[model samples]
Target: IAEQFVNTDLGGQLGDWLDFMKVMTLSSDRKAAQPDLENQRLAVQVMTIHQSKGLQFPIVILPFLQSGSFPSSLKKHPIINRLPSSWMNWEQDTETTFRDIHNREERRVFYVGVTRAERELYLFGPTSRQSMFTKELESENPQPMEIKTMNEHQDNSLSLSERKQRLLADLNREIAAKQIDNARNILDELEKADRGETADGSTPKSTSREMLHLSATKIETYDTCPLKYRLKHIDNVSERKTRATLEFGSIMHAVLEEFHGLKIAEQTEENLKYLLNKNWREDAFEYRLRGEEFRKQGEEILSDYFRFIQENPPNVLKRESPFSYVMDEINVKISGKIDRIDQDGDTLAIVDYKTSKKKEKAETNLQMALYTEAILRDAVPGVKGNPGKANLHFLRHGDDPLSSHQFSEQNLQDSRIKISKVADGIRSGSFEPDKNEFNCRYCDYKD
Candidate 1:
């Protein structure tokens, strides 16, 4: 029985190989081995809403749907709500407006989940639960299982402190409204009090103009969400530092930069290893427990980096030029520490080293595009050069071949326009926190 079952092709060649086990097997054992067998053959799939994209399934059971379940109610409101409408059209069409953007995306995902069922579909829900999808599903299908489970009793009751908080909130709103009324009454009384006073009065006390200092990030923040910016900057709420991949990338970058700064002949394997040991931060282990694994990975990365540098030693002619500048600035005082700036007489090249795994199509990032703009405008004076002429190098992990992108002025400008739009949104206080499951999983601000 084991031999026959093992030899039976489950789906394809891979499936056949997976099923072919040397030991004895049972129905329970096989079920345990392939836990997805129920949904696998039933033409029904039980998947998280995100995984349902770009594929068709006859039936999809979205068991959990609640305020904090599917479309998490924890999403922070957009900064646009605080803006005094001279800046943005808050009353625009629901589909086009920024206010409804997140809701629309959520609805689209819900729609995709619903449409995935080719034939008969079932949407299960609890009592008192309502959503756009819930309404649509009920209207379309008409019949849905209404399951009501007994609510568990809790030992704890509302505390005195909790009651006090509710009372205080009510009192505060009443007090605020009363205060406004009182202020108006005071203004009317002040006119009667000052009936005999001169129009000029005694010269009003001089007041200082509040200084406004703005950075590129500040401007961007302002456009994204004014309220958020106010909360972050004016209120001085410190954003907590969380898990950042930048730290890992920085360590690798520092090592490579050091490697390049050394004399060409001195960049040997032994010397590189010595530099890696000297520069490595022992304290970084506190964030991630995979310190030993990272060390091994770092060693592997160093080996690859060393080989690439040896093969493509900095071109001397390209390096020596007035067009090339390190840590150049773009708009908003935005500057980047360019790894290698190369100039071939009329043409310019910006090379950035990445320690990430290689992708099929190497693309230019916003940071790189900004760097190219800075180089053209700030680094090279009076040179109305073509943006497409510039070179971009992406050095990946392992000794794989470098991926290159030719920077174009048009592309750079287009990138700037998009960045500026984002900046504008932030400046106008329209920035909203996009709720994503992946983000929630890794986010330090999840609470």
Candidate 2:
């Protein structure tokens, strides 16, 4: 739409038009165009206080209402706070402290949440002691209301195990104490329970299990921490965070995928820049500053990538190829999308892109091994025979970007064995948390 408008009104000024569009999209006026969800459906809606702004519902249930958790203590960003005020152009307000600002925002959020309930508003918190805001809200009402316990209406179809009961108790305790991380962990435990997972790292005797399905990410995640893998892949509990690096990597992958689809003659640095410009997402990053920083980094990486591709134009056979291979021994199916594949002489070459900080070795990389084996087994259409080479194209590494290695029969056999072992563990429900510090550092379920 911007392109069409630019062509018609601005005489084909695409770059300027793109800048204008971005500015307008980021402006506060964009919220006016948001679809009203109040009358859209007759189902119960679950949303955050921010999402509930300017919208009302028939019933609003505000769960996990605790002092520190709901209002959230005034916490400053370590890096941002340490930076000079002059550098950030921050103006210090002598009258208002950081805590004041935090309190005001929290109060506004609570107010919005309270007003969202048209007919009934259910506020849940600790029975022993309530949140500071809860006192203020209750004081306004001043009248006694009927109370109910959570376990009054139990479903006949569902059975609450002792572990689940303990988890529920723990969730209540954590919320009362305003232990946010502990509450999240308990919530994950409850989700696992709902999915028929036992607390003792064993599958239920009554439940029938299916054949294990594996992907490169699944294998790697299981290897990193089985509990994390089970929570993410099995129970489908995603980590809630707007990671700038992941967002940048996704944009890079999308742009490169589209760029590689073009003819070799059409693949130029200018075209690559145009692709980046076209696909750049401002909302993906948590902060606008970080987004701008990544945008600059993207241009540099793409410039290097464009030069490298021009110098050694690959015989590209396929782009973003999806393949599924079944392991006969373990009866486990492994599936993933290969970034690119090149016809290297008599054999095929599997190319996988990476935006990781560290370059990966093809010999040790399970993804490369899996992709190579899949192609060799004729699992991927239009590709056959043993892989001549496996390439890990590290986009972040300006120097020594490509890591190429040829897989031996022994390496392939070992990978299969590894897969078999992982499958066996998963099949038996061995999702015991790996408590390694390195593995737990950036884990979503970390407490």
Best by lDDT: 2
lDDT of 1 by residue, 309-356 (tens): 677665422231234333212223344455666544566566666655
TM-score of each: 0.43, 0.58
lDDT measured at residue 77 in model 1 versus the true structure, 0 to 100 = 64
Estimate the overall C-alpha local distance difference test score of candidate 1: 0.52
User: Model 2, 1-447: lDDT tens per residue?
Assistant: 443343344332336566767766786465435456776657677689999888878888888766677788777676764544334554753565567778898988899998998898888764323455776654356342433223334432124556675676667667877999999988988988876766654566422246668898899898888888877776555564445677788899899999988987898899999999999976565334566899999999999898787778888888888899788777788999888988888878888889888866788999999998888888887766667899999998866789999999999999998888788778777888899878888776784
User: Candidate 2 local accuracy as lDDT?
Assistant: 0.76
Per-model C-alpha RMSD: 27.8, 19.8
lDDT of each: 0.52, 0.76
TM-score of 2: 0.58
